[model samples]
Target: MSFDKFVKNLSEDQKKELLMVLKESTDTDNKVAPKLVPKIEDGSFTTSIQKKQTEGETFGVPVTEMPRFNKFEDDGSDHKDKQNATPDVELTERRRPPFKKITQTCTRCDNTVETHPQFYREFYICDRCLKK
Candidate 1:
């Protein structure tokens, strides 16, 4: 059945019991509650670009000169240098251990098994409880 229909079918006593269970499971005084307004005042957050622009500073370097490279002429000197160079260091590859699965117990069943916790809320109820 749909959640709304199931909830509506519950008696007054059942509803009160569910509410009591939920209230007991949660932490009412959590410090991570979201703020309604920003901590800083208006126009307080400034970026580097905005600061530089305000001071009339240029953004990037001017392209006044171009780079030059030497022309390649093969005289077998590079090959001779490679042959003369000796191995200074050795490198070894490392292997990591395989991941192991973690198991959690269902709060309702009190058994050691994988359990799905409620999203955006506290409490773990196994598949058996969920079906009910």
Candidate 2:
């Protein structure tokens, strides 16, 4: 309706009553309204939620403690030898093959490398391999 027509039809008391009823309905709307909290997904892969942070904390903190090596620290200073220092003399020993000084004889060439006891059992390797 036009302003003049509406004012003409609505008495002052009727207009006041209508305004009050409208305000009341608007107020009641708040009570019936649903909250808009975010639907926090469980953040889980298989229905298992990973704890991002403790209850009292708002954010997660990373563990930083790890192993560290220091060169200067030493408990046994008397027994410790300097890495850059070298000894006055050295003792050397020669290494030998797995088998040596075989009194055994080769079955093919009759070479005296067989007739040994509790050995690798390298019974024969010459004549047969040469034939092959």
Candidate 3:
């Protein structure tokens, strides 16, 4: 029997009892499952206690001083020849690789045509047939 017909066969008291049982089952399921996240109250969560900081430890080795940030000194002993060297020639024109075309028969028109691999894979139709 259909769900509508089965529900229609139930009396008024039986329908009320079924609804009560469904509501209790859902409430018990929600209470039994563990909460994934903690609930926040008054717009803030509980803060954790901070641990004490220890000094003079670098990769488990005791160092006398910490490294300074953004400080670099140049002694000018390295790259002395490269600074005075000059290039002989330089190209002024931009170069690009040639496009690769594949021959495939058009799905729409049976004529064989050359097209890029990407266009053939996407539409499987030639440019002339696609424009038409």
Candidate 4:
């Protein structure tokens, strides 16, 4: 018989007793199994590790923080002074230029299309021409 049918046939007291037994078994199993610790390191994949001789405490290489840059006060150019300058501000995003969409003309057909400028120049063809 299917498990659902068997469960349906069981009395209320029997179901309660079965649940209690199952819960106790799960609790025991959890207690028996050792909890795994994730190994977190720079440029290393995160992996679950168990207690073993090979999984002993490892010395990590100390990483130096990026040097903070301060604007030259005595520069000849007069720039607006920042009221609240944070040293821990990220430098990457501010340095990057925003992407602008590029427009291209289809060589096969006299059709104009807008496309992002790529590193390698590619010939633009209209979708209708490409389908043919």
Candidate 5:
């Protein structure tokens, strides 16, 4: 895309035509420096860190300095520092949250345990599938 490189391959008339074409293609936004495209160079083609320009949460290992994350980010809002964490005694006394409870009346074998809501709300997946 450089003028020096492109003009080397052109005749006088063809150069004029090429220059006109280049001028026509030029726009005001060239200040953004067209994305540095890596061809077959830059070593491996499968690197995940050669990230695309983005405006959102770009996940995975960052190409630059990695921001520190505490334990909260790993388990989300579940885990916390020992000082702020729920005591084991309290957890044992509290009723099990619904998300963990197994229900009955499963479309599969009802006589066993109650329905596991994770499997029942969608379709009946028996204990066999649960093992899977």
Candidate 6:
């Protein structure tokens, strides 16, 4: 019989005993397995610098005690005394040069034209004969 069918046929006491046995097996497996730790140094198994930094009290300062600047507050000063008070030159957006069209002969018609290549069986043809 299938496991689900067998489980369904079991009595309440039998189900309880089966669950207890499964729990005990898992507990024994955990106890028998060895816990693994990654090796760091070539000479000794010392704790990493990152671990030391995280554990030490001197590594970091509280955010409330850190230095900060007030961005909104501006000290008032005379504008005329400052150098380059007004800009002499104006800035403008640059325009790109137009694309240069290339001419090629169509394989089917032997016509010279400046247009995108149209695909034939294994060769390129001009637009006029490509439809045929």
lDDT, residue 128, candidate 2: 46
Clash pairs (backbone) in predicted model 6: none
lDDT (10s digit) by residue, model 3, range 6-116: 999999999999999999999999889876775667676677776665563346344446563444788887766966767688767858777899988877887787877
Clash number for candidate 2: 4
- By how many angstroms RMSD does model 3 differ from the true structure? 26.3
What is the clash tally of candidate 4? 0
Candidate 5's C-alpha lDDT?
Answer: 0.63
The TM-scores, one per candidate, come to 0.21, 0.24, 0.25, 0.27, 0.18, 0.26
* Consecutive 10-residue window with the lowest summed lDDT within model 3: 55-64
- List, residue by residue over 1-132, the lDDT tens digit for candidate 5: 897887787789998887787776675446557676657756765855566666544576674766653444454655566778865673346686657667554456554456545655645556665675
**Model 5 per-residue lDDT at 96:** 62
Kindly give the stretch of ten consecutive residues in candidate 2 with the minimal lDDT sum. 59-68
Inter-residue clash pairs, candidate 2: 104-113, 104-114, 104-115, 105-114
Q: Residue 91 in model 6: shift from native, Å?
A: 99
Model 1 TM-score (2 dp)? 0.21
Lowest lDDT 10-residue stretch of candidate 4: 55-64
lDDT-wise, the better of 3 and 4 is: 3
Clashing pairs in 3: none
Error of 3 at 100 (Å): 96
Q: In each prediction, how many residue pairs overlap at the backbone (N, C-alpha, C within less than 3 A)? A: 0, 4, 0, 0, 4, 0
For model 2 the local lDDT of residue 23 reads: 97
Candidate models: Cα lDDT each = 0.64, 0.64, 0.76, 0.73, 0.63, 0.72
In model 5, what are the clashing residue pairs, if there are any? 103-114, 103-115, 104-114, 104-115
Q: What is the lDDT of candidate 4?
A: 0.73
Check candidate 4 and list the clashing pairs: none
Error at 105, model 5, angstroms: 26
Q: Where does candidate 5 have its weakest 10-residue lDDT segment?
A: 68-77
